[model samples]
Each structure stands twice: as C-alpha cells, then as structure tokens.
Target: MNLPFNLSPWRTKLRLRSEAKAQVTARGSSRKKAPIKLGLPIFMMIVAVLCGLIMGLGSIQYAILIVAIIVAPLVLLMQSTTLIAWLLVVSMIVAGCLQYFARVEQAHWMPFLILAVMLARVPLDAMRAAKPGERSDGVDLLGFLLIAFVVLVFASALVNKNPPMQALVGVKQYVFPLALTAAVTLAVAPREFWLKVWRSIPWFLIAQLPLCLYQYLFVEKGTSTAFGATGIAWDAVVGSFGGNPEGGGASGALALFLCFGIASNLALLRSQQISPRLAWLSNAAAMASIFLAEVKVVVIFLPLALLILNRAKVLKSAVSAAAWLLATLAFVVGLLLVYQVLHYSNKQTGSKSLSEIFEFATKAEQDTYTYNRETGELSRTGALKTWSQENIGRGRLVESLVGYGPAASKGFSSMFGKGTVARKYVFQLQTSSASTVLWDLGVVGGGLVAAIFVLAFVRSLSLAKRLAADPPLSALAESCAVAIALTGSGYLYNNASVNVSSVQLLASLAIGMVFVLTRFAKKQAFLPAVSSQVKVVKRQVFRPRIGT
Candidate 1:
C-alpha cells in the first residue's frame, strides 16, 4: 500500500493525548456554563455550624467538625492539586495549635478530613486530563497494599463488633495516612508543583522556632487544662504542635519534627542544594527545640535517619564520609549538652553525665515491661507485655486474631456505654503505636500495615535510583525512603502513628510525593524509548528510495 505517512506506530499515544485535551476543554466549558451557586452551600454552612453548636454545646471539637464540613466540599470542587498540597503542609504545621486553642481531643481531624477529600477526588481524576504515562505508573501495587490494609481495618472492626464511632476514630489514626498514597498516586501533577510543596517545609520548620521559644520562656509547664485534655503538659515548647497554655505541650511530636528537620537539612547540605550556613542555622534551631522539648527519642531516631539518608552518597566519597561523621558527632554532643543543661536544676538526674543519663534512660525503658499499677502509665514495653498477658497468656485466640474491637485499645475514656480493653486494664494503650495496632486490629491488620510500609519503602528506593539524573527528585525520593523507615520505627518508639502526630503526617506527605514522582519517572522512561522506536520506523518507511 502507498501511504503518505505511517500513523500506526504513534496512533494510540496521539489519540490518548487528544482525548485528554478534549475532556479538559469540555469540563472547563461545563464549569463556565454552570457556575457554582453559593446559596445552597451557604445554607449548608449555617446548618453545619448550628449542628456543631448543639452537638458539643459550642465546644471547639464540634466547631472543627463544622469547619471540616464547610471546607472539604469546597476544596474538592476547586480541584487544585497545588491547593491540596499546601493545605496538607499548612495543616501539619498548625493543626496542633488549632487543637490546643480549640481544646479539641485527638490529633486535629482537619488533616484527615483534607486527606479524605483527596481520596474522594481520585474517581474524578479519571474525568480530568492526565499527562503521558500517568494513567498507569507502577503505583498500582502500592495502592492495592493500602486498600488491603484498610479492608483489614474494617473487617477487624466488623468481626469484633466494634462501636461505629470508636472504629472510625481508630481508622483515622491507623489508616488515613496509608490511604494518602492511593490519593496521590492518581492525583498527579507537574514536578514543579510537588517541589514547591517540599520547599515550603523548611520555612514551616523555621516558623516553629519562635513559638517554641515563647512556650519555653513564658508558659508555666503543666498538663493541658483545656476542656477535653487535662493530662500531660501538652503546650510547653510544642511550637505549632499546640496544647494548653499552662501545659508542657506535644514534646514528643515536636521532637519528631525536629529530628526530621535536622535530617532533611543535613541531606540538602550533603547534596549541595542549600548553603552550609543555612543548613547549620536550621539544624541549630531544630537542636535547640529538641532541648526545650526534652524528648530523649531524638537521641536514637536522628542518628538512624542520617545513616539511612546519606549512606549511599557517603560511601562513594571519602570527603562526604568525613563531613557526615563530623556532623553526626557535633549533633550528638550538642544534643546531649543542651539536654543536660536544661535538666540541671532537676534533683533526680540534674548532675548526671551524658553517659549516665543514657544509662538511666536505657534502664528505665527496659524496666517498663511490668505494668506499674501505681502510676498507670503504659510505656511501649509495658503495652506489649500487657497485650501478651491478656491475649496469649489467657489463650484468647479469637481476640488475638481479630482483636477485642476497633478503638478497644485506645486510652480515651469511653464515649459509648461499654467497657473497652484500655478501660478494663486501666492502662494507656495509646502510648505505643505498635501495641495499639496489635491489640486493636490484631495479627492480620498489623501485618498488613507493616507490609504497606515495607512496600512503600522498597518502591521509593527503586524510584530514587530511577531518578538519579534528576538530583532534586532523587534526593526527595531517598528522603521519603528514610521517612518511611522512621515512621515504621516510630511504632516501636511511641504512639506517633496512633496519635496522628506531626511525624506521621510528615511521613505521609513524603510517601505521597514519592508515589507522584513514580508516575513522573515512568513518563520519562517512556519518552526516550518512543523516540528511538520512531527513528527506526522512519528508516523502514523511507529507506533510501532505491532509485535515488
């Protein structure tokens, strides 16, 4: 057949691209034709506010719910991935303060609400135009992993007959962040948009310095006296991770953020992306905040994070190894010195050396396995111990498999008129995220969650290698890999995941970005192959017109 051109080879791609453009045009025209109406939305907002006021009698928690109801729909309608990214960042930085000021219980639900909206928009993504190779980007495995975990949560809840409200609260803490991977997988955008989102993280971290300083200097340390919170001092030096005015604040959460800040800055510094001066300044602020917060976990998590983030690069360069080693030593000594100085006035361990303090902390941690009936504080070890005693020791096979019920292991007092595992044991189950997952979701659910983390880390690491040509993106993917490791380790260290702490939120954002980049990497890989194939086709079709 004599043909003017061979269109068969590129027909599919061209057709898909044209169809995507048409879909976008149609959607835009439809929006212009039927502009959004404010009347019904305004009425809904009023109803939400009135319902909130009546439900909680003007309490802040209900007020937040009202805001969630009003904001979520509008955000979904706007359908700006950039706006969604910013909201996640802003909410992570300040949601704690909002919770503290409003005196709401649990991690601020606003971030979770925002995430839910992102997930809901996934279906609409099909209707929206997508870039080349975005329709399938190797994140299907990650998405399936997350969805399976969620299904496990629901199944466990149903099998154990968990209260609906209680089950939902548990799901929010355990499953929402994992769901973020699926949300971001389909919700793809330009690389610059994602980079801008990451660039804002440092500024937000710097903003916390002022708030931490104020809390340390002016606030009298104690537990929150807010309406629902009257326990640990959750306000002091918590930075934007707010709590009550007279309380100690979210020291654990803040410390986790500081640890990430230090690691991230160091990573950027190693990559030569930022000036050493700026990196040092940011690390100093984070270290100082760690001292003010007085969280000991940083001593462990920071070193591990640095090692994971820099090992590959450091191994290739002797200078990098030396620089990293020196920096690690400096951070360690500075952290210990600052922590010792802050606690010098306390009689118990004020005079102890860094070595002695470490020894004491180690011993105290090791001894926490046996429940302290006198204090009722459930340390991580204690939580695991107690879980084993009640389930394995007593041979409660059914309960061991599916758990007592969802939210059954939480520390909160029962809102429903029923006994919960936490209440029955009179121990704070929220102290250890690992134990909470084990006791609440049981064996199958916990395994699924672990699998999600493992798969996410593996995929991120692979993506990092694939994006080696793009240093910024490569570093970001490696950072996500490290974040996933830290987040999983957090289950052993504290209830960061169970409480929806800033660390978990930050890790979720990193994982989502990694998945988004996976799509980008796939697209990049496709173009080069397509170009070579097109050249081959041209050679075959127009080969040296023999007569010429």
Candidate 2:
C-alpha cells in the first residue's frame, strides 16, 4: 500500500465522510417536514368560532343551501360506493319535509315516490354492487315469521268477510316488510354514514319541538279530530289534544323524545372523536326539552333509564340513582305548581277552581278503577286484550289464507264497500281498520297473525338486548329497538300499521334501520381494534430510548 502512494486509505475516508453528511441532511429535512401540532385550547377556540358562525346564520333554507354546497360534492365524490346511503339520506330529508308540511292524505305519495326513485337506481347501482352474503340466517328466519303472520291475519280477514282486509295486507306485507328490509340494508353501510344519520336525528327532533309546543299550548282544541285538527270549542290548555286533551298520548311522545335524547347523549359521550363539552351541551338540551314535553309517563320510565345507564356502566349506579330520584321528585313538584297556577287562573275566570278540577280528576280515576275492579274489566290494558280476542283468532282459517282473494264480497259495508253483504257487515261491525282485521279474517287467521307479530317483537327485543351488552352496539341498537317496540305497542289499538301516511312510513323506516343496524353491530369490532392498535403504536413510539 505504501508503494501505491497510500491513495486507498484517503479514498475510503472521503467516502465515509460523504455518507455521514448525506444521512445528516436527510434527517434534518425530515425534521423540517414534520407536521406542526396546534395547542388544544387554540384548536377548540377556532372550532367554537366556526360553530357560532354557522348557528348564527341558521335558517333551514340557509342550512340546506350550505349543506348542498358542502355535502353534495362530498356525496358525489363517494357516489360509487355510497350512492345508496346518499339516497336514503335524501329520502329522509324529503320525508321530514312532508311530515312537517303535508296533510296526512298527501303524505302517502312521498314514500311511494321515494321508493320509485330507489327502484330506478337499483338496476344500475344497488343490484350491481357486489352483494354482501345473505344477511344473518336469523334475519331470514325473522322475515319468514313476519310473512307467515301477515298471511295468517289476511286469512282470518277473508274468513270473517272483513272488507278492510286489503288495508291490512298492504301494511303487514308491503309497507312493514319493505321498511324493515330498508332499515337492515342501510345499517350494513359504513359506520361513518350511519353516524352522520344519527347526528341529524336530534336536530330533526328539535325542529319539531317548537311546532309541537305551539300545538300543545295554542292550536289544539279540546275535542279530537282527524289529523290533529282543532275543533270549534277550545278546552283546557294541555298541549297537543287541545280541548279533550290526550295528555297520555302527548306524554307518550315526550317520553319517546326523552328516550331518543338520552340515547343520543350516551352516544356522544362515548365518542372519542367528539368534544366533551359538546356532548354535555347536547345532553343538557335533550333533558331540558324532555322536561318541557311534560309527559307524565316519564315519571315511570326515568328510573328505568337510570337503571339502564347504570347497567351499561356509563354512570355510577349509586350516583345516577340518587340523581334520578331527585330529578323525578323535582319534576313532580314542578308539574304540581304549574297545574295549580292553571287551575287558579281558570277559577278566577269564573270556571271551576284548581281544587275542584283535582277533585274531579280524582273522582274520574276512582270511577275508572272501581269499574275495572268490579267488572274484571281490563281498563287501559283492555285495548290489547280486546284486539287479541276479537281479531287474532279469525286469521287461522283456510279460505282466508291467501288474503280472502282481494276485493271479494264480504259482510257489512259502507259507501266504501264492495257488495251488499260487505255493506251489512261493515255497518254491523263498525268495520274500522282495527276491527276489520278480525271481522274479515276470523279467529284462526287473526291468531296466526298475532303470533307472527309476537314473534317479531320477541326477535327485535332479543336482538336489542344482545346488542345492548356490547359497548359498541348499545347506543344505536337500544334506542332503535325501544322505539320500534313503543310504536308497535301503539299499533295494537291505533291502526298506525295499516295507514300509509308519510309520518307512519318515516317512523317505520327509522325502526327498520335500527333493526338492521343492530344486527350488523354484532359483526363490527373495527373501532375497538383500531383503538387498541393506536394505543400500542403510541406506546412503542413514545417508549424511552435506551440512551437518550
């Protein structure tokens, strides 16, 4: 090497120095390129300012415009995979508008129209999309049970020569099943999409609250009319049912809203992505609105909710129970105060004093209680019993099975009836939709139908319970299932099932979405997985160097 003038050592040294320099330069560049992190307070301030701006400019029309500008493009960008989800969202918006503005009769067209649009797209998009495997066998089994029940009910109507069988068929077979299917389909969509929809629900409820309040305080007259019409004579100011106040029903709606609000609050609270302050505000608003709704049934249900919240471990059982009890007592005291004020005002106006009103209410309650006790009558509970006894049994017969051959002559009719026999039966039976189910189908048909309904209810309840046990699924599934159960219970007497109005359709759709989503929740553990993985990665990255 000496003989070669020692050039090899110098060359090797130069190469080593150059490589070290290059490595240093690369490291420096990467340090410069790293993202700048904003402080939490500053970030939150910016967000708050933006939200304030948006809210200050709030008008539904303005909101819609902004949403269209922002969301429409985003939706389009994701159209390839999310077209159906977008369509469902659009349908909901339309349904909401119809519910707010349209008459009951006019509302029927909205869902059908939406369905038509959906069908048109189905050929191009929904059908062509790689279908997920046939959903859980459980859902299929459920569908079969529902279909069988409808068949049985229709059969009963036929045997009884009930003229209203057509309505029943339309509801049980077409409307309800479709609603359920749609819900399930929507549920299988991405979590982000469903969450977006969920967020919108509270807003929708809020919007309705003012109108409902107005109806309760001003528009509703005492006497009941179809479609919430105000009768000529105004009665006591109770809220929705103006004159002859259906305080119970109004309370039911309020209770429902409370349930929804509570669910929403729980969801927001558990959402790591959302701010804690925002969650608190939402929870507060929901609670306040529920209080204003003044539904007495909540007195019974609040404890149940507290128990649930505790069971879910979202809250401390002891603290939550104490808080709930105090709140209930406060609510009762508040109601009494309000009632006293109203009662005194009425008396001062030369009407019965508040005490007199209370006495009258007490008397009526006692009368109802006494009658039920003396005669073994069911009281409020009798409605379901009556429906079962009168209608459920008729659906089991043979001739009525395939729906009594639609439009066939049946007994008792009105101008709406098909034949003399149909007219006679209609008049004799007062064949409204509720009564017609039994009158037309007979006991066998109705009983089978009833059994199917029972099965569906049981399935929904069971699934809901299972979902509630899973932290991830509990929020959406519990809310949706409870809503469906409540609505279904109402239908036992109200005939909401047979009606094809917009509100009814929207409600059914919502329920169906819940069912579908809850079922899908069983397979979803992605969030939990991602969260754990993030924690592991964070821990590894932040681990102390061996020699810092």
Best by the TM-score measure: 1
Candidate 1 residue spans exceeding 4 A from truth: 1-67, 80-83, 101-107, 126-139, 220-235, 245-247, 266-280, 313-330, 346-357, 368-375, 413-419, 538-548
Q: Tens-digit lDDT track for model 2 on 1-548?
A: 24746678889999999999999999898885667677766855765565557757754334433444443434433433244444444433444344433422233233444443343343344344435775434446545654565565454445546546444333333434353344335433665665665665555444444544554344333234534554321222222211123222223444444554555556545644345665566555555545445444454445444444444443557776677668768866676556445333443335455567668546644452323343233333333344444334554344433433322323322224453234432222212233334433444445644554455545544555666545444555544544444444444333333332322443454445545555465555456678899999999999888875
Clashes of each: 8, 46
Model 1 TM-score relative to the real fold: 0.79
lDDT of each: 0.70, 0.45
How many residue pairs in model 1 have overlapping backbones? 8
Q: Which regions of candidate 2 fall more than 4 Å away from where they truly are?
A: 1-105, 112-140, 153-177, 186-188, 216-255, 272-295, 298-309, 312-472, 489-515, 518-548
